[model samples]
Target: MRDPNPSETASPFGPVISAYSRADAIADGVLVPVPESIAKEAGFRFPVALTSAAWADCVKWTDADSEAQPTPQDETGRLWDVLYVTAHAMKKAPGDREFEVRLYRVPRDGSTGHAKPARLKSVIGPGDDLSPVITIMCPDES
Candidate 1:
């Protein structure tokens, strides 16, 4: 539920997704905060659908000149500071028509880097509903 944007005027790829602590989700039935270890882990997947395409917006570096592009070394301690997806997907179940959702976390802070924000071509449209399948986490500041 927290907006990880660096500034209001900055162009964002999509709404920054928040993480909830596992404890809060079970105790209060709320999902807004993320666990401290999430950043260090490779990634986590939930059985939730990204009903809206807004959740899949992302930043991409389009410049062809490799020398001009920002390197990974420039992003130390700053990648996840903002947050963006490394990978994401939506798939229909094998037997039933129900869809499943997966969002992979990018290692760096994609929200404020030199990349331009771009919409994910693979994102699900407005017709989908992920609230039932996914478990939302607690807010970062909470």
Candidate 2:
């Protein structure tokens, strides 16, 4: 019979390999922590973070980008859009621990266009300390 707890069983392959924690990811800039006050305003009771890819896709805006694009946009507005949509989605499904959310945001790329639709995945899971937390990331990201 196999052990239900893998940690209790001896691995045939040998000792455990390398592992990365959520804290490590945040420290390495792979994940960016959203301000607690802003996250609370967006209806998140727990800590929230965004994967670097998602941040680049939606939150990273600059004056140069606004000048290049026809529509004027700012980082605050972009981040709010993401958080608002994600929060609404979570409210719609209160029982789900993990789900995907679709939101529209203007692309930061130097292009003239309207807000483009993007899919973000919201996961409510345990953090480094086994505390509930939320992480929003692009569909392609982990």
Candidate 3:
């Protein structure tokens, strides 16, 4: 897709993020030089929130086609803290696309990913926050 601002055109898809010099973005599509106000928030991490774009986007080979590589389970078969960014690339080609974010863990480093099928509940305009806030709701319902 064409960048809205040509003066600062070009974006990342991982692998070559370190050379990113734009004040507006980081490698893997994150907004760079993270806004100071956001950094001052109650809780934050070294890496800012993932941008609508993921580290990489493609027609993914998920489930059994890609799931058995390795996982993040412990000896007792419990999951741990290594969460990979699993996102859904919504929207058709031409206009820029958007991603729905979630954190998933693997027992090891190379497990094929599993993405449950989802239906569009509503049309989210653009950017993050498309995810709904359900303080308490049944997993099946959400």
Candidate 4:
């Protein structure tokens, strides 16, 4: 994953190139990397779970809001940089869960739960400005 905090602290989230126990270990597991198109289309984030109460720790596959406040905006009129986080629940049948994309604003602190970090702003999809779920992210942002 690129530095999770790329704004200033260096992206904590990026390509994770590592070695596993064995080739079968990789084969036996179902770890699917986010496709390049999905990353580009969404801006800069990958699939994640924000439900974790503690963002610093990857407790579960859930996204969460770490800081109690929203991330401060920069020079641009924008409040945050675009970064989509697709969330999916594993299926019993297994292959992979049908993922759902949610925009997230990854603040400079390497936390996806920040109030402002370009994340999903629409419940429908990206570039979708017409909807009740303008802040498709955590209810707090809305």
Candidate models: Cα lDDT each: 0.32, 0.90, 0.28, 0.31
Better of 2 and 3 by TM-score: 2
| Model 3 weakest 10-residue run by lDDT | 75-84
Among these predictions, the greatest lDDT belongs to 2
Candidate 4 positional error at 67, Å: 39
Q: How far off is residue 129 in model 4, in Å? A: 39
Clashes of 1: 18
The candidate 2 region of ten consecutive residues with least summed lDDT is 7-16
Candidate 3 structure quality by residue, lDDT tens digits, 47-74:
2332222211211224542455543223
Regions of model 4 farther than 4 Å from truth: 1-26, 45-142
lDDT of 2 by residue, 5-31 (tens): 987677878886898999999999999
Best-matching candidate per TM-score: 2
The list of candidate 1 runs beyond 4 A from truth reads 1-92, 107-142
The Cα error of candidate 2 at residue 77, in Å, is 1.1
Error of 4 at 96 (Å): 28
Clashing residue pairs found in predicted model 2: none
Estimated TM-score per prediction? 0.18, 0.86, 0.18, 0.18
lDDT tens readout by residue for model 1, 1-142: 6668658856576665875544444455332323435533524343322211122222222223223434432332222322334222223333232232234323234333254433222221222233222322212111
